[model samples]
Target: MGTIVVTGGTGTLGRHVTERLREAGREVRVVSRHSAPYAVDLRDGRGLDAALAGAGTVVHCATTPSGGDERAARRLIDAAGRAGVAHLVYISIVGVDRVPFGYYRTKLAVEGLVERSGLGWTILRTTQFHDLVLRVLQGAARLPLLLPVPAGVPDQPVEVREVAAHLAELALGEPAGRVPDMGGPEVRTLEDLAEAYLRASGRRRRVVRVPLVGASYRAFRAGGHLARDRAVGTGTFEDHLRRHFAPGARG
Candidate 1:
């Protein structure tokens, strides 16, 4: 098998992709600022070339936090094209085109870069992850009696593992352009999701749904961040919560 270079291989989803590729007995090269099994900084052209050398595929799971610049995506795309990488797989969020949020905008920009890079590429767009849901709820739970929910919105959150698996499959195959969008099986409100999380965690708390007044809220309320008709995840919020909150369970 040819070398598979996975950017951001240490991240939440990247780790799973790296493991899956490794389990398939493919030589894996990881790219990041920090040193690991392999290391390269996307911002540095020379480092990127060194990382892409002899690699047939590049799975890009790298992302900047909200409000950060998106130049990284352009840089990675340029490097992939210049290095003659055969396949470039990118992980993107669902509904990026409809959502006006800064992060989604950056994601859309990255998708465009990959599309026009001239390298064979695949884009896997997935919904919010189960861990993201928990993080939102848990952070809100820290505050007393106030759980801030996205007002009047529906979300179909999926498991990160499912997204990771789909991404790995794409990385191993020929580029299929934009693959099927993935999401959790059930549609849910943020309020209900938060309440479910609290109940699952054995917390007796009243949920106060706050009307988030902003572009973010408007986009979410319009379901601009969800996948329609392509929900393919096997785990539900309840299942995820049960596994997360189970006694002595380490996920």
Candidate 2:
């Protein structure tokens, strides 16, 4: 098989995806701003074509919350199209179309670009990752006493490794447009997740619910980001917490 280029290969999701592909004995070229030899910034086309040259599949995982995902996708698509890449697999959030958040909107727009890129493509929409939920709670726990979390919002946090394995499988196969959604084993309220986080970290902070205002918040509260029927992931958030806080885990 030809080389598979993975963007953002140094990042959390991309790292696992790259590892999975390599374990499968595939030729994997990791392209990122920090990845040497094949370093390329998705924000612009600089060095992107060189990284994508002779690649059979390109897994677009690089993303930012500070905006500009659309531009990045455009550059990547242009480069992939020119390089004669066969399949373009993209990772996206489950509620991109329903959520009004800027990042989600950008992701949805990127999905549209991938669909129209004139190359075979696959899109996998997944729920929030366990690491993200834990990170948010960790940040909130920085408060002296009470840990405030969004009221009425629930999250289904999937394991990143599981997602990476699936993405690798998709990359090794033919393009399948818009596959089924993937979700965590269980869906719990934000407050419940915060409390669980506190318990897992041995913190004594009281979990407080703060009602957020906005269409995006409303969509989240209404479970627009959840995939109750698609609870395909086997790992729970607690499982992630255990591994995260295990001995030598932080290192």
Candidate 3:
């Protein structure tokens, strides 16, 4: 029932998490590069101590896909430890351990850091978010005549609001390390998702499947990133599309 700090509180998932926490009437501090009074960059530990001071829980949602997440997590752990924060909750991708992608590797490493940080910690791994899948499709749809997608790759895209609600629940409860993975209600192929996007956005493009070569691509094709058994999320990808393309839906 103390102040809770959310890193990257302005981001997609972080924003929802912050809203959920605030709805519960908990004191919430949003710490981010642009969050005034608590503008602390996670890349380094600068201004972190002040942000974490007297906070009971911290939801670590800040991550850099371009790299340097390990450094950021290390700095966060050290600061939380120094501030005597009770619980540290982290959001991670489901296949961090199975996928060989560089970003997944960094996420796995950050999970390890949280586990060994000697603090009350919890980690929730979920499948890809619907927004991320939409972004990929949108980028591919930008091509003149063809939308190229990874062949044989299936993604379970979960809703960010559901993940955020779960994270807020975890942040309020006692720390339970590495909880069960959360997945979307359905598993869909990239081609199918792309077609859906085209229909929703009213775009005309031929969807092409490209069998990309690489260990990471192979891992993705092999369903290493899926959580079929933990399909606890409620919203579907189509549901996301409707919301996304709705009139004045720009978030």
Q: Pick the candidate with the highest lDDT.
A: 3
lDDT of 2 at 205: 95
How many clashes show up in model 2?
Answer: 0
lDDT of 2: 0.93
Off by over 4 Å in 1: 44-46, 66-69
Arrange candidates by lDDT, highest first: which order?
3, 2, 1
What are the per-residue Cα lDDT tens digits for candidate 2 across 1-251? Answer: 68999998999999999999999999999999989998887887799988998999999999999988899999999999999999999999999999898889989999999999999999999999999999999999999999999998989999999999999999999999999999999999999899888888899998899998999999999999999999999999889999998888972
Runs off by more than 4 Å, candidate 3: none
Residue pairs with backbone atoms closer than 3 Å in model 1 (clashes): none
Task: Kindly state the number of residue pairs that clash in model 3.
Answer: 0
lDDT of each: 0.84, 0.93, 0.95
Instruction: Give TM per candidate.
Output: 0.93, 0.98, 0.99
Alpha-carbon RMSD of each model: 1.8, 0.8, 0.7
- Ten-residue stretch with the least lDDT total in model 1: 37-46
Give the alpha carbon lDDT tens digit for every residue of 1-251 in model 3: 67999999999999999999999999999999889999998997789999999999999999889888899999999999999999999999999999999999999999999999999999999999999999988988889999999999999999999999999999999999999999999998999999999999999999999988999999999999999999999999999999999999985
